[model samples]
Target: MNGIEEEDPIVFEISVVVPRRNLKLENEGFDCVEVLVNEFRNVGFFVDRVLGLHDEFIKLAAPLETLGVVAARLHMKKTTHIGVDLPFEWEEIEAFMRQPDGSLFSWCERFQCYRHLIHFFLIEKNSDVTLKFDGIEIQWEPGEALLQRLELEGIVKQVFPLHDETKRNKLLRSWALNWWDLISQPIDEIYVYYGTKIAVYFAFLGMYTRWMIFPAAFGLILHFVDFGSLKLLVFPAFFISIVLWAVLFFQFWKRKNSALSARWHLNFSVGTSHGYKLSGREWNCLQAPVELVKGSGIDKTKEKEDLQRYEWFGYLRRFRNDVIVILSIICLQLPFELDYAHLYEVIESDIMKFGLTAVYLLVIQYFTKIGGVRSLFYAVIYWWVFYHALLHRNLMILRQVLIQRLIFYEKQEKARGRFDWKDTICYQGGEKST
Candidate 1:
């Protein structure tokens, strides 16, 4: 039976590693490893154990039924031809189906489901269930998670996803090594294997490369070809054409993006706001507004006030951080830059100037990271400041979204248990028809 089992294809994707240990008998006490394996099995996972010289590996595979149930619970959004999102329903599996590759879930999606299940869903059932792991006695508290406890105690080393060797080799040959056709790419296969992000990135890269060909050809014509009297007019025309090409390329890229989203059955607008809720992994800390309002003895007016307070506080905090960054740059970096410029101008020998420039560059790279202002080094400071500004701006946006969601929850409280198209479609960031 063991030999036959070993012959089966390695379908399990997740593996858990722990120090090598012997299995305990039921007569003695509950072995930690055995209990964990049983817990996985109870949760509808196919668990297999392999022993190594230094560690024991616990391999796990989720059945289709388990994946479906988890997906529904997470309220995962799937693609529709109409370019809208619908929450996953296990009872009606055919409605929220995957793409033509016949993969029920992308590698990214499956990993998320597995992670949530193991980390949050698997809870300790019994009280005072003391377990032993490799000669160390551990307390298994009631209602506490076994895996999390094991992790805390340093019993479990690490958990990571394993790749299917067959699919990996095939992808390597078809996509990575096939250089004969530069434009042709296995986009669908890439999407199926790597999920949407990687596929979309490569799609854009390929499209950009293809678009550059026309400009390249045009530039060659302008460079080599001689047009004696028309040369002055040709320069302006070439400049205008280049600008027009860039504008058109960006506009067309959006169209291509939309087309890909529709083809992949992705709900672009809906998924963008709720991107954090992949299989109940992120955004778990923030409960639904409805749930918060429904809690006993809750005061709605006070809650809104608290949310408003938090929102302003977050903005102020970000402002303070930004002010500190600016002050530091002005106080520390500006003087050094000025000194470098003064020295460069005063220095006469070419070799001395070159050496000074090199030293200045190294000093700038080390201290400011952002090079300088109103010179060749000016771009670095601008880029550095822009990055910080953009980061804070995104945080502010997220804060505003959260506050809006809370307000929407308060508004919905007045609707009195009514469910309509408007309510159904509205999500965490709040939605409007227009």
Candidate 2:
């Protein structure tokens, strides 16, 4: 909420004032109340039109919208910010997460609150809302009735600054327990058990943290240790272990993703209303009709094939552009390399080697995002895997892994004929899906 106090609450059609005066913090009510109201309206609009699902169903799609909002804030614009107080009782949060009769409405309502928090932090200037890490640092801080509650119950253990080694072995129930309980339920029925995607997302994060941290430990060990002549035994063994662990982790994920999809009924089949047809959502026009073109002498099958070919060729074109872009970059840098090597005898700075390389790779990634640069996007990924991996550039590696997952899932959908070429690119953006 954009907190501002004023006698005339209505500044714009989308901004409303909520009056609040607590403790010494006497001021205006939030201004952006209407903005979030509109955001939910937008969510409703998509659910009603595109998702073709009900309100309870909106709980599931809302996470996707929330994620899409975060993506937009990250990539496109940071125009809106809102915050809502979340005061969840530990027992209630647990009961909602665990009990058969828990209210999903309450749980999802909290998630929407969290989503607003995400939007607030998306604006770089407003990122100070969190107490770093597990929220333990502020556990002893006195609570105030006026400000938003930062306490998150059930997700974290009772965090205190001083560690009691004596109680190290003592077990405490965790917020993670809530997610685990959801996971332990029949995967298919998890939807009925908990209508919140945060549980699944957190569960995946737990698994991913373990998987990623284990490899990083090995990397750190390699960093600190001097293997000397026995290096032969160390490097190869670490590499093989990482690769083996990665394969096992991903294989497990493949099954997990499949199980969830199946439970959610996303298996695409003709006339199937449930599976790969969650909302029967297509990349289609929701606005003006796309008028059919007058026929040429082309056969229908040939026309379809041509359409598909042209659609997928964007990848090929992207690759070509990536090559051209990289060549141009190298051509510009060739003079510097030569000068560093001979002419001016200037040694290449570390900034040029690592920092500038990251910038170039980022440019490639950005280009890939801009509709015409898919090939360069992929090229950047491949280069990261090869060279960045060699340098142990974990950040770039992480980005590539996430991007590849999206690409992989997209390809899977395409392969299953979730939508034909006509429904893919030819569809309208429709109200901008804004």
Candidate 3:
């Protein structure tokens, strides 16, 4: 090859001025300029020039210096064409250049010209400058000849209106409506679920403890005391318990299904319209006819009113009813279990047992109201006393043994663990490194 072709490399330079106040708020110190520069580089712009200014100059004169120093340092090692401009009066220029920290001026040998009148000069230019600010156009030739003519205009003018009172008020109203919708809707739905579940469970347990446990225990004690063949009562007692449990279970199941369906409708209505697709479990659980009611078409105000009505009737009132029924049964069975001969004698004598019953009921009620594990212990104790009087044999003990077996069997099956040699190899690096 007689001649090898060589092409001039493309050189690009950009300058950005940041106000000193803005820099102080952002960086807190001059040393943080490097961090700012790296952030700009990450956005793909190659900064080949920088200029730093004193705080007073940026506030009262040009604010370009705050951003300039950061820009130059970023390109300092990569290109010889990199430069920085410092704003100094002509009188101080020589003395400032001579300072030990003033080595930044050595790069200024490439300065094209100085334009003093406009407070801006062309230190170096590989190309012309073109910029637009607030609809005003700016163009500079590829030299410093007209640099002094470019006016040092004050802060840029606004092209758009600063305040739109109508828009602001509309945004605030919309935000308030959305926030109310979020709080009221979700809370109502959660309360409905909890209330229905608790009510059903309480009702079932009450019937079981009252009709089955209390009667059977008392019948057993009578057989032992009288030495008569009263074992025949055991079959009738068992039959009644089963019947009570079945009826209660059916009622609980019905209410539980209704509550679950309502919850599904609530979830589907709120989430689907907002572009969220339900997960597989959510989709399966909420796939009910009630959810087909379009949430978008439903008025939130009307829905809220309807939900409040349902919450009062279907949840709060129903739960209170169930609580009253359960506690009434518990109170009625306590004396039968305690074998209070005086109370039994009063009932047998045709005198009302109300006074003694009420007094003992209040005592039991007070003890039950004490919270925590203590309350649970007292409940179990009452259950035992009632069931023993009704059945003679310890039904509570039998029930507890059955429950423990079921729970422990499941736990034992799930407790099996797996070991893999691959896991040991994967973590082997930890042993070596340490």
Among the numbered candidates, top TM-score falls to: 1
- Candidate 2 residue-pair clash tally: 11
Over 4 Å off, model 2: 1-200, 223-226, 263-434
lDDT of each residue in 1-434, candidate 3, tens digit only: 12222322322322334333332333322222232344334433344433356221111111223223333433222112222233433322232222122222211211211112122324256775554333334554556433232334322111111122443355446433556553222222222223334534554454445556555676577656654454344444444444344445556556655774343222233222233222212223344312522443456675566446545666877899879856755553444334433233325332234344444444444433432123432344345444444553556544543354345434534553223455676689778888
Task: Put down candidate 2 lDDT per residue, 1-434, tens digits, no spaces.
Answer: 12211222111111111222122212212212222234445442222211223211111123323433433333321111122222233222222122223322323333343444322332123223222222222221223211122223222212112222222222123232455553233322344334436446645665687678789998998999998966745765565465456546866777776766543423232222322211122212222111221234545675566556645776898999878888744443333223222311122454444433444345334533443435545443443234334444566544644464455546656866856765665465543554
The models' CA-based lDDT, in order, is: 0.67, 0.38, 0.37
If both were scored by lDDT, which would come out higher, candidate 2 or candidate 3? 2
Selected candidate, larger TM-score, 1 vs 2: 1
Q: Provide the global lDDT of candidate 2 against the true structure.
A: 0.38
Worst 10 residues of 3 by lDDT: 109-118
Taking every candidate in turn, the Cα RMSD to the unseen true structure, in Å, is 18.2, 24.5, 29.8
Candidate 2: 10-residue stretch with minimal lDDT: 8-17
RMSD of 3: 29.8
Ranking by TM-score: 1, 2, 3
